[model samples]
Target: MVNWQFWKRRTPARILRLRPRGELSDAVRVEFPELAPDVRTYLGQAAYLQLGYFETLTRLIRATPDLAEKEALSLAAGAALRKHLALLAEIREEDADPAELMEPFREPLDAFRRATVGARPRETMLTVHITAGLLDDFYLALASGYGERGRRVARILRADNDRRQLAELLTETIRGDEEWRALLSLWARRLVGDTLLVARGALLLDGDGRGEAARAVEPVFTALMAAHARRMDALGLAS
Candidate 1:
């Protein structure tokens, strides 16, 4: 069993380095939180699946826009998360099927499927909005134990060569279009900043520099998200 408790104690060095030009709004601070035991446990799994999603997106960003590939990645991430939910339900003796476990996200999933399959680029951004919104909505329902499999996924997703490719792809993605650049930046900023806390807690898990790797990636994520949010606000994409 992965000792998430062990990793949960190491305050990652990156947290202090994050000096976003503008202060995070009160709402953004509210969106962030200290690593509670429960939150750490949930991220032990969530982080793993997120790694996979990122990997797939990294690859697809370079390949010709293949709707099937995008759909496959979304479904796989959704299924993995559902499995984690089922595991949690079983531990609590609450009978649950993995497929049914994702019921709360059905509408979002539908939106994701639609976006992944032949939706216009603008529609695809909407899908990301739906996906992020749904995750926020049901975040507390996530599972919290035996996150090793998820870690394995993360390991595969974050390989050095892969990450390099990912960085390059993101650079190209930003150059590809105005909307994509904005959306990618906003998403990256939020995810990187937030996930740093996750990595801080996972420092003891591998003790093999996983924490360091996470810290190294944080700035890139933050910059991207910040760029997107700025553009979205400028374009009146935010309400």
Candidate 2:
């Protein structure tokens, strides 16, 4: 139903302000002629989610008083914004209206933010780490059936090692604090459940007419849970 080729001749201002046209990668040129409309819409919503998350992280970083911690959050936020912009550019090239694509996700993402708001810096960092990891797993799962361009975008989304440094910082900060560790673990589990709900919606929307692709749900959830367990273990939390 959405026009997949709306931006064929015109570049959106928001994207153009982020990077010049010549600097944009041509690697996202691969065709996905068989990709379903719902799938594309889902991808567009995912992009907006990333953008919204980055915005919230920026606010959190500004509110943080510790110079070192603020710097770490800043780095992670900048990297995430860059990656999201690249993904949006790719989606835009396929004729998706960046604004329209993000509209449906606005209320849902806002509700998610409201429901999972963290109280402290450590808790916030843990939330960011767990959320990113789960999203990466979901993207990797969907990328399994994507064309070259979609896969490339997925790789960009998954390449978020910049945030790992922040995770280590948080881990060390809460190392011997039993109460904090328990709190963080609890928050992480809650975020995982919330993220799973969003991922399921996206996957189901993506499965409209593609039967074989639809069947990937179970394997993807399994993989995501396994990866999440490993992350908890890395943070010295009980999985």
Candidate 3:
């Protein structure tokens, strides 16, 4: 078995590095417990991630020879860029430099991209599909932490990502060959560990919280897995 706990091999890193620049509000404290990152942490990580997705899909476009595949990837890339810009706008409204806010996360998030990106184009395509879906939902779930600002972030995350085309590309390829099916299924299984680790790392957990409080993460974890299974099923790949 490929150890899904692969993030263990890397130096430990924190994804949410800042205290809340403003109120995270009391609502999330009551609702999500210790899981809410501050508004800036939320904004910076969310924006940078979409930018990373845009860049990855754009690179895939250059490497892909087929015009139709290139076009499909372009739509997904463009969608990610739109979300990135929208997040930058939100950062500016808060009177923070978008570049500065995003700077701290550059190393860790880029490392995440390197870890999740694949050796083959098909595998890379699947990487974007699975990771984006999981993280998008994860962030969306966490959005309510910042009150109204969080709501706006939620709206941006909810926008059409045009990732379905990426899915179509993967599904067509997987159906044609058992080898691709097996390879992608295995790759996807490996990805879930790293992807979930990124989500878990971003959360604000107590220093020694345990038992039921630690297990509070279980529901969010389960929700992420359910959504992941649905995506794998869409590609006819085992979760």
Q: Judged by lDDT, which candidate is best?
A: 3
| Model 2 per-residue lDDT tens digits across residues 30-84 | 2122222244564676677678668768888888898888888888888878877
Model 1 deviation from the true structure expressed as Cα RMSD, one decimal place: 13.7
TM-score per prediction, in order, is 0.29, 0.77, 0.86
Poorest lDDT segment (10 consecutive residues) of candidate 2 = 12-21
- TM-score ranking, high to low: 3, 2, 1
lDDT of 1 by residue, 1-239 (tens): 11123434444321212222221222221212222233333343443334333433444444537664445444544543454443444423323343443343344333333334323433333333323322322232111122443333233322222122223333455667888766755554443333333334333333444565545544434543554455344433442
Q: Model 1: residues >4 Å from true position, as ranges?
A: 1-95, 112-167, 176-239
Q: After superposition, how far is residue 175 of candidate 1 from its true place, in Å?
A: 3.5
> Which has the higher lDDT value, candidate number 2 or candidate number 3?
3
lDDT for each of the candidates?
0.37, 0.63, 0.78
lDDT of 2 at 198: 64
Query: Can you list the residue pairs that collide in candidate 1?
Result: 7-201, 182-228, 185-224, 185-225, 186-225, 188-221, 189-222, 189-225
lDDT order of candidates, top first? 3, 2, 1
Candidate 3 versus truth, CA RMSD in Å, comes to 6.7
Per-residue accuracy of model 3 over 7-60 as CA lDDT, tens digit each: 222332222111121112122222345555567767888999999999999999
